[model samples]
Target: MPNPLAAVAAVMIAVSVAARALIAHRGYLAYDDFPILSMADRNDPTPDYLFRLFNNHFMPGGHLLSWLALRFGGFGYGPFLALLVAGQAAVSVAFYRLLRLMLPATWTLLVPLTVFLFTPLTLEAGTWWAVGVNVLPMQLAMVLAVGAQVKYVRTRRPLHLVTLGLSILLGLLFFEKAILAVALVFLVTACLYGDGLWSTIRRWWPSWLVLTGVSLAFLGLYSALATSSVRRPSSVAEVLTFIGQAISHTLLPGLIGGPWAWFPAGDGAPIASPPPAARWTAIVITAAFVAYTIWRRRTTASRAWLLLVFYLALVLGLLGATRMGSVYSAVAGSVPRYIADVAVVAALAIGVALCGIQEREEKAAKIRMSPILLTGLAALLLSSAFTGIRYGDEWAKKAGRDYLANARADLATLPAGTVFMDQPVPEGVVGPLSAPYNRQSEFFAPLPEGPVFVTQGRDIRVFDQAGHVVKGWIDGPANRPGPRQGCGYRITGGPVRIPLTASTAEYWHVIRIAYLSDRDASATVRLGDGEPRGFDVHRGLNAMFVVVYGGGAEVVLESGDPAAGICTDEVAVGDLVPAPAN
Candidate 1:
């Protein structure tokens, strides 16, 4: 009754476009997207400059698309991610169009496009286009490649086979997850479509060999090389729940109650464990599908079951590998979302269940059922699109305009490799400041590269690679010594915990100086209060520290150190700690 395939594609793209435009209208929806704008504003904006994503840390292809979108979208994270989501809709269209025979038109169309509308997963994928946001592209590539393979098997056409190989190869360019795109395709072919492989290969030898080779190449490159710190699940239950959460989170839209992404149940949430509910669902689903397949013999349901197993297997393997999976779970650069790629394939594998047994009576029934299904699917997709845009689910990029004007002006003043002891992720500033600063001052600390900033005053200090401080404040900024002795405050070997407090209405400063040793640590320092101190602390084992705590204290850790002025990287002014007693 309904052309489900066309309807799904139309709805997916239309919604994605609408979302993109909405975000574009709103400006950079979130501040994190500012980094790309920062880079694009730089004079040397190249792959090298933007290597923070690929080389330094693995973010998504959102950065690539965002920079490119500058020509169209112009200065917004929302629009950039929106275009990516929209682009995937193209792949969604191609997905059902390519699956002409693997399923009835209704089943083929509904299974693939439903994922796009599955609000939770889509919303998770929608955030932060610059880093780990290309889940959509990776899925599209993986799915499109698989679809090409399906077309090859169904139609024995050389073009289909060639296209399949090319698609898989190209998909690799979009994501590291895409490296497995070829392996997944062949794995599916080998396990579920075992009978068809040989015949299909014989018919399309050249294309098959090329794609197969490409798949192998992808596997070789996709190996997890980075050192992983993610520990494996202590119990199988946690694993199941984790996997189940991904599945349930994606499929059962009603189960997810709100706009929030993850639910925190336990304090500190410590369980050297997996998500039991998720894993159990995955295992049970796989076992049931496999058992049903064995009982019924090779129908599409069995195939779907097998595919579900493969998806779970891949997810488990990554977690078992416990290296990449851990990084994926923690950093979320794009791997966990790959689980949905399997969901799509599994839906295809169980193409029969979706159609309710192709019978003469069912054919009449399908006609009636198809309309209701189509209407519901349309309603869901349209709603999802509306929610995505109107409710601000995801964003896209603006036409690449220069966002570097402020960064350039700011960076030029500071010395290269100068570590700014700012707070919060160095994405952007937030909130209002009421002058003289304290521990509450907010600034950007962790940057992509250059000089790393390690602050102990506010936030965690993971930026410090070494264990505990061997010498407490000595390793602070190199120039922080003059003002401490000038003020006559110091740290001795004994437990000297001086509760230094300061509060003022105007902006001032606080400097703590720790030298390696007080030996030869001579300081001829004139305090802003016109007090001067000349002294020499020891050299090797000894250390020295100077702290300027007041309202609007703007003296350098070292005078004439060129890198110390206009320290606007963070404005630490608040109700200040009053000037020290006379």
Candidate 2:
């Protein structure tokens, strides 16, 4: 007969993987996927090429995987999604292995393992391809490193130490936050084996010293070579504030569902704070747990108490080091990708506590289960799983459908070499579901002459040279209003000429200018220094459409009108295609 416990664990793992696979059909996100795919299209996956591409980036492993996805997966996201699910499954297995080492491998251990597998905090990490690629690999490496540490502690084997070191290195290669794995290994060692704090340090000085040295060396290289644009905590106040906020965000969301579970968006529904009652209750419960843990520490250094402390410390140190990057703000600390590791640690800490309680009860020759404890644990597990699945469906179904519709609409109309601005997608769209191509104007590269496209919600509009939406082309509501409704360049009274260089002269056929003026005015617009044409502008907002026949056009705003000069809001020149008449 099969061990029922083992069967349950296997079933849970299978379910988790199956759930992830079902949601993996969602299309590519714009965040890092677009840039990675673009890179893959341009460069070959050679050692030298990868080195050059990732020399300034800390995540070479992520980049390599993305390159492979593009090379082998073709344009479809199915292959990349498969890889993500596979990585997550491996992390789950590694987690189970670590838990087995820490607690008795009995049916009870399956509870925490199941909860960890379905933790709502993993939803973002598991769904988004780019996030999953970066996070899942690092998580797997961190778990393996912890497992290696456990093996080394038990067997005192040199091979285990070597494995520990290698795993740490692999984690670091995947993400800078992997350094926390080293700290966790040391903390676990001290808690499990050391006679006292100082004694543990004295014994493990050499190991920690080596790890610290490696960390410093890596930091030095990263500082010199890394070109990431993320801002670092600039002052002591910022660092402290970030640490405090990160801790709160991690603990609160992992313990109870909150606004952080929702995917952020430009026009999404507002996120409501947890009710005051619920908030205070969670705080009281957490305080009680901490107080009890501390009280227990005064009597005996039980493994559970020590493990809980170590886990908290690990969470603090990890968030402090990584969350300080500009990529993460204090408010954004609860982001699932950032806190997935914390969820794992919290699960382990809970498992260890349960194990300690059982051990104590056995020693006393009386086994008693607290209904309150069991009820609370069950509630937390059920709530987290419910929230995770609910949001996972939103991301997979609603967001996925919106993204496909937008991609198809834009791709069908927009031609190559078109320079346009991006409109933020609808709120509640979890992944990037806006425009198909890159939308960040700040980093857009020069393109050859082609048709330009502008977006307002899901609607793509063609603009004329005077910066006006082309009439008769789009027959719908004149405009779609949202938070980012009017996003474009604001040009004051000056010679604002949309530059059409030699490279972009032929591909573009028309220039669209969307503008507004305080008073009535007219400006001379020239295309590629060709014959100058005069255009009249009305008060308030106006659109000017001009055909681009040659190189590039220069718009000379005449300053004759003393009144507020024309404010050019948006300008785009590209291949303008008229929509089929309705």
Candidate 3:
């Protein structure tokens, strides 16, 4: 007869993958996905481009995969989605392997694996391309490394040591935080397999030394290249608030299939939005489970739970120090991606506590029926599935899909030689913080056969709110008519200054020159004592906009070419905008 437990486990794994595949299908590239793909498309496959830190993350492996996906896959969504699904499946299988090694064959073995597979807590890491690329591999490595450590402790094999070191390196290539995987292995060995902590270190010093060397080498490279400024909690109160939000609100409920409510997270994916009742119920249930496990006598349950708490503290500490100042800090814990690896570790901990690691001499026992436990497991699975489906639907409705589709279609239709005036994407796509990446040039780089983009152009257009190409103009608080009544300001070989009717403020602003030239001229324009910028004045009447720094009382224009001359009548200092309709 077929083993019922094996059949059940297989079904759960299938359901989990199918559920995530649905989410990936419904999802579109969002936020950082734009920048990741843009960077990949813009640069060639050089060590410098591949290994360089992106927004503070040193993820050469993820970048390499992205570059490969772009090279072979083009701009289609298929390659990225396939990579996400494959990575997720690898992590699930690696985790199941770890469970098999750590626990005996019993119905109890399936519970933690089930939770790890279905928890809505990992939805973001599983579905989002940019996040999944880094996070999924790290998760896979953590499980594999832990399992490798278990094998080494039992067999003391040199092969297992190499595998363990390779696993850590694999994670580091994808995410800086994977350094924590080494720490987890230490926790597992010292707490679970050791007769005493000191003895374990004495016996395992060589393995520890190797892991440390690998981590230090990676950190050395990371410190030199990472460009993001460190964000630290500003106050004790802020730290405490982050802890409460991450632990009490996010982590606890997440473990028990919760944050039962889903709300759209501004322009990004939906975040956990559990009501008060959901939060408290999660707390009661999870707390009771942990307490009962620890209170059970003669088992290594306390030690296993201790390992979990230590790892949780480590994760919390890292997040509290770095992410406490986030714009979404209030809901930082509710964000699934940050704590995705925690679910993997928690599963390992659950298995260790329930079924001690000691090998059983008896044949694998059949799963004993327990009415209460079975019902609770069923409820958890059902709750998680509902939440996952709802989150996927929310993801499908996001604006990124429509925006990318419309922009890509329209860009292909633009006339040849129509250069775009660079600007940040519509605020709905991403915020100002994304910078050079959020620039129209970078944002649209992945669109196959897109038009060229330049900072300043005489024949330039702009993407309007709906991403359609349109005539570009500059609108500013200060629009200065030429000081002269007629003929405006003329340029020969020397500088010509036109005083402004209103003073421009001290900030980055665009200046537009409306001019007519009998001949093309190479010229320089300067704002009050700021650095001079070069521009071209074409024959006949035309307008050009250039970004300038510092405030000024006038516009200064000059031609380097003695033979070339131009006339300008107006200057506008502020932002670039779509030209107003006649």
Candidate 4:
């Protein structure tokens, strides 16, 4: 009465969905994903809002998801990522259905689970909302497109024709970075029956036309709003390199086991780049599989096998061809993902191979019937979850929580609309993520505009009105860390004045100073001709010298007992404090 296989698939998929959704839901959005907010603020009031939106190089699905988030998120990030992860999980199930149709009863549940479990990176695509939105819809389109084609051939129904058309349309939405498998599907169909135009047209014509229509529509859409720069393939040798990378990235330690030695450091570090050996290995394996299948081609089942192989090969060859290397270069890195869909078809061949065997000893029979298969399934899920968690950790590091807590107190002090410039002030945030403040905003919407100074990364004049230097800093005083005595620092070309409209006690922007002192260096603060004051560097990033007496001075980071991570660099004085409490 109860199907063990169906139950496993249901449970595993549900668990996978919940795990990935949590990761996507937890963090603040950054970089490319955050750009959607800037675009939303575009003030572009025209029908072309959607049209112009897709023009950016990032694929489409992400854009659509973020826009939807803006409508309801009030521009927040959590719900947006949550929605994307959920969508991706649903689409993943769609691919699961496609697997069900292709695999036999025994392999049906195991194969799909094995594939996801083995591929760790899939979690990143599934969990990171930006990546999830792009990957899931495209994978769903691929599954549907293939499914529709399969149904059309079996049923010869016009409804299938319409379905295929829509699937193709969905597939065309973005370069999708995954649809390169279409060509493989085509070639697999070709190799099944010796190819010819009329025969080809009859058997695969609908798919061909549908795919073409999809291509044209997507290209038109890309042309309309795209300013994406094309990446050049560095060299022909890169072909071999990319394939190798794909192989390593795709099946390592799962399909074929390997020691943990090869794994990268910390989950956040970049993955292994494409390697050359893996590429050729893939080719050899594919050729061997096809050759064996064709040699054994006999029953109607064998003919179907040939179709899948030929279709997959044609797609690979088309994608793999290097003449216009640039066009296919990024694909080399993407090959692992491409192989995932192909592996589903390949799993069918493997199942057939196992089923075809005649006789075996009891022990041997168990290997075939259970342990090898069961162990493989368990291993796959564990690997996938591990990989997913690694990616989650990586996303968090890139998102920057530790640094934000330290910076936020200072940033919060400055009212919105205040501009405090310093080295590495991340494009929109007060400090640069690479340099200091996490760069999070899309278009830098300056809250308070004034002179910006300090230069560990970039110059300040870019955001200032007068093109003169204004240095600003935010840090706690001395070793003590908290709200009080928070040393706010800044330096500008001229004297700072409290606007009649602004409170005299509440300075819109203050000053940041670093001095060359050990015990305590007291300095002077003079607004126009106010008075000289002194302050000490709290820990670091706050070391700058301000010259209040000499035209309005500079702050030099005083070196004494070496701080944990301070490089010997000069600090500017008169750095504006958001609110100079003193």
Which candidate wins on lDDT? 3
Specify the poorest-scoring 10-residue window by lDDT in model 1. Answer: 264-273
Query: In model 4, what lDDT does residue 264 have?
Result: 34
The order by descending TM-score is 3, 2, 4, 1
Worst 10 residues of 2 by lDDT: 474-483
Alpha-carbon deviation at 130 in model 4, angstroms: 2.7
lDDT of the candidates, in the order given = 0.42, 0.57, 0.80, 0.45
20-118 per-residue lDDT for model 2 (tens digits) = 666555434534455556565566766555544332346767767877887775556777887878887898888887887766665557656866787
Each model's TM-score? 0.55, 0.67, 0.90, 0.60
Judge candidate 2 against the unseen true structure and give its global Cα lDDT, from 0 to 1.
0.57
TM-score of candidate 4 versus the correct structure, residues matched by position? 0.60
Reference-based lDDT, residue 347, model 4: 45
Return the TM-score for candidate 1, rounded to 2 decimals.
0.55
Residue 253, model 1: lDDT of 34
lDDT of 1 by residue, 1-582 (tens): 876556655676566545544434443434334444444444144655443433223333445655566545454344565565566456556655545545455543454446443443344344435332445566667667777776665676777776777776555555555656666677666654555767645654665587768867655544443333346665565565555544444333311211223332111111111244644553555456456444644454455555656765676566444433342353222233435455455545544434433222234334234575567556555545543443342233311112222432344455454433432221122112211111112111112222234332211121111111111222211222233433333333222122222223232232333334323434433223323333344444322223233332332222222221111111122311222225
Off by over 4 Å in 2: 23-30, 48-57, 204-206, 213-217, 227-250, 256-263, 266-273, 287-330, 357-377, 397-582
For residue 506, model 1's alpha carbon misses the true position, in angstroms, by 29
Q: C-alpha displacement of 163 in model 1, angstroms?
A: 2.6
Better candidate by lDDT, 1 or 3: 3
